[model samples]
Every structure is written in structure tokens, then in C-alpha cells.
Target: MARLNVKPTRMELSNLKDRLALSTRGHKLLKDKQDELMRQFIVMIRKNNLLRDEVEAELIAAMQEFVVAKSLINESFIEELFVGTETNVELNIVEKNIMSVLVPEMNFTTSEAEVSSDVQYGYLNSSSELDEAIDRIETVLPKLLELSEIEKTCQLMADEIEKTRRRVNALEYRMIPQLQETIRYIQMKLEENERSAIVRMMKVKDMGD
Candidate 1:
């Protein structure tokens, strides 16, 4: 803890007293902000955990479907079918501001299934299982992206909350109290000097008389 360098003077002391009062008020308001941020951060953390679990489960299911599709269909046939099809996916990243934190936004064009043609290549036939797998993957992509955004946002909020809490503690427990103590000490010293000067002046007047 760094000690504050407060020069002891009447005007300086008055200023410090005012600063102490202001710091005390600021400390209270900061505490309230910290509490509110903590509450929101905790809620987001809980949601992040739940979303992570759900994403993991969905990913596992999607992988299983991919494996089944691969086993049921021939690789070369699938390759030929997709060769002329456009598989280029474009994703747009947007930003959302939450409590001065920027979070990620994911947006994409429609899935291949929604925009695919009815043409077939060689002896390849697009099965319902393949369509199901593609649909499920498409469904999970946006949710996974959302979960990622939420996790990052929660982390940022938690960090900010911790910083605010530290500042509040410093003002409340250290800075404000020290300033008040110094102000009291200065006031007492000033009063004692004033009383001593009055006594000295009275003695001189009595001697002159």
C-alpha cells in the first residue's frame, strides 16, 4: 500500500476533507456496481456451462451421423456428387456491445441443403441420412457460435468486476480513511497553535499595563 503524500496546510486540509467525502461516496457507488456486475457475470457463467454441455452433446451426435453416412455410402460416389456442387460457406462476423464489452456475432447464408440442385452424378443417390446429417450440422453451428460468444463475454465481465471490486476496497478501506485521519490531525494542531498564540498576546498586554 502506497502512503498518500498529504501536505499539512489549512487550505490543503480543507481540500483533502472534501476529497475524502467524495471518495467515500464513490466507494459506495462502486461497491454497488461491482455487486451488480458480479450477479450478471455469475448468471452468464452458468448459462455458458449449460451451453457448452449442450454443444458437446450435439457435436458428438453430429459426428456419429457423419460416421453412419460414411459407412452406408461409397466415398467416391459422395465425392462425385459434391464435386460440381458449391460447398463454399461464407460467415459474417458482427459485434454486439455488452457493458462496454464487444461480443461476437455469427451470421451465415442458408445451408447447402436449402440451396442445392436436384442433379445427380454417376450412380450416386443423396440419401435421407445424408440430408439429416447436413441439417443437424447446420442447426448446431449457430448455437455453438453463440455459446462461444457468451463464454468470452462472461470472461470479460468477470475480469471487469474483479477490477471494480479492488478499486472499491482501496477507496473504502485505505485512501478515504487515511485522508480523514490526516485531516483530523491537522485540525487539532491548528487549534492548539491558535490557543497558544492567544495566551502569549494576553501575557504581553498585561506586562505593558
Candidate 2:
């Protein structure tokens, strides 16, 4: 049902034949690329699911610890003791390429707010339990970020796969077949014309004889 705009001529037919060949080759290549990308996307999707679950579990545990820490020690004392010990933290992020796809890498760093607490005002001070909670939160943060990035990358890859699939279908099922049919039609017409011309020439020669 699809219509091509240009009028078909000898030159145009030759060009169509060449284009049909190129499209067939391109279709195969794109099909392979799409398959590879889909495989990678599926693997990343599985990893993302696992990481998401782990992050959720760790976040819950950290929250519970925070509650326990708050109950065990006075808020004012904990605040005073930890405030001055805070240090600045910087995270180093790197990008990784898989099958020519660039994915994000996450790094965790300890910040001043994480290390320093306000516990100087009273006898009660921050304990290892609080540090444990902070550590768990820090550990989960990067994983959560990684999961997010992976999920997004998978989505983008899926979209590309769909687009490639459509192009392949068009070439393999529609455009190439139509071009071949047109070529056959032209060849048959030319053959018929040649046969008719030969028969007429023979009749004229016999009459002259």
C-alpha cells in the first residue's frame, strides 16, 4: 500500500535495484544490533530489580536504627558532640560503556554532615549505632542511584530496539519485495518486445526471398 513518489525509468529502476540490495544488507545489520542491545537491556533490568529491593530493605533498617538512636540518647547532647567533627565529602563518578552504550557509575563519599553530630551539650553522646545507621544509608544511596540509571538506560534501549525492528520489517517485508517485483515486470516486458521484433524481421526476409 505504500507509494513511492518518483516516476520509474530505466535509470530509476537501476537505482532502485541497488537501493534494494543496500537496504537488505542494512536490515540484517540493524537486526543484529537490536538483538544485542535487547540482551544487554534485559540483563541490566534484572540487576536493577535486585538493587531496588536491596535499597528498600536497607533504607527501612536504617530508619529503624535512627529511631532507636534517638530514643537512647538525648537529642541536644548528640547534636553538640557531633557538630564540630563533620567533614566534607566528594564522590568520584565514572561512566562505563557496554556494547557501545554508556552507563552511569556512582561513587559514595562521606560528608561533614554525616560525620559531625551535635552531642557536646550534655553527658549523653553519639554511639556506634548511629554511625551504623549512617553507614547503611550511605551504602544504599549509591545503589539506589545506580538502579535509577540502569532503569532509564534500559527504557531508552527498548525504544531504540522497537524503532530498529520497524525498519527491518519495512525493508524485508515491503520495500525490497516491491522493488524485485517491479524489476521482474520490466524484464518480462523487454523480453516480449524483443521476441515480436525478431518474428517481424523473419517474415519480411521470407517475403523478399
Candidate 3:
């Protein structure tokens, strides 16, 4: 590292020493923060993975039921049923902080006054498979929303981890090293000057004797 441009004096050495102390302390704190963020990030990733697997399995099962229902029923009837149905679902988003990262919390609400049952279609014209499919689809709704929440949280945590990693690296590799080198240079220069002054004083005393 390049030596800092400063006078070879005791005051400059003291000042550089102080700066180095502060930099060292700051580095430790930042490293601790990075460690905590990493721990939180790993937990989020695990949750995301589990939620994704469960949601995918549920959706696949629902799709199979839908396919069976389609095979047993008329396509026009299925279309007509949806066309006559009115859906009123509202999504509200709330946020909370985790390790300084903002993550979304979703609340899914359906109008109970308008939508009360899982089966939107009538029983007379639809097969049992259709009803099963409808029930499974309804069961998947909250899980799907939960999956979305976890995935978004994972993304936000990942970003924060990366940012923290950068800062830690900068301090550990670059800033701390530079401060140490500058402090060392200042100390060495001051010592050499002090030695020179002592030698000059001794020679002058010898001449006077």
C-alpha cells in the first residue's frame, strides 16, 4: 500500500494511529452485521424451498382433478359455469423488516357476503370430479399466497446479503489494510527522525567537551 502523504511528526503518527483504531473497530462491527444477515438469509432460503415444493405438488394434484373433470363433462358447460360466476377477492399487502430488509406480507380476503362456498358451479350438471377439483383449487389459494410471500422475502434477503458481503469485503481487504500500512509508515518515519535528533545532540556534546 502507498504511504499516506503527511509530515514525519509525532502528531501525525498519533492521528494515524487513532484513525487505524477506529477503522479496526468499524470493520469488526460490519463483519458481525454480515454474519447475522447471512444467518437470516439461509433460513429464508430453506423456507422458500419447502414452500415451493409443497405448492407445486398441490397445484399438480389440482390440475389432474381438473383434467379428469374435463374429460367427464362438456366443455361448453364448464365455460358457461365460470361465465355465470362472480369472483370477489381482495389482496392487501403489508410489510415488515427482517435483518434490515423489507419483506411483503399478503392478506387474501374474499367477500364472504358474495362468495361463501368452494363449489362455484351447480351440482346437477357437474360431475363429482369437478367439485373435487374446485375444493383442491380453493385449498391451494392460501398456500399459493404463502409461497409468493416466502419467495419475495427470499429475494429481498438475498439482495441484502450480497450488499453486506460487499461492505465486509471492502473493509477486510481494502480499507483496513490501507489504514494499517499508513500507520506503520508514519510510525517508522517518526522513529527514524527521533534517532537522528538523539545522534545530533550527542555529537554536539562531544564537541563542547
State which candidate has the highest TM-score. Answer: 3
How high a TM-score does candidate 2 get? 0.72
Tens digit of per-residue lDDT, candidate 3, span 1-209? 66667876778778878887887888788788778878887887888888889888878888898899999888899888767766688999999988678899999887663346544556667887787777777777888898888888888878887887888787778877877788788778778888999999999999999
Tens digit of per-residue lDDT, candidate 2, span 1-209: 44355554667668878887898889889889888988888887888788888888999999889789878888765566556555566667677766566666666576656555332333346666776777787677667767777787777777777887898898888887877777766666667778999999999999999
Q: What is the full ranking by lDDT, best candidate first?
A: 3, 1, 2
**Candidate 2: which stretches are off by over 4 Å?**
1-13, 71-102, 106-129, 206-209
The models' CA-based lDDT, in order, is 0.77, 0.74, 0.80
Better model by TM-score: candidate 1 vs candidate 3? 3
State which candidate has the highest lDDT: 3
- Residue range with the least summed lDDT across 10 consecutive positions in model 1: 114-123
Separately for all candidates shown, the number of backbone clashes (residues 3 or more apart, or on different chains) is 0, 15, 0
Poorly placed runs, candidate 3 (over 4 Å): 113-115, 118-122
Report the backbone clash tally of model 2.
15
Candidate with the larger lDDT of 1 and 3: 3
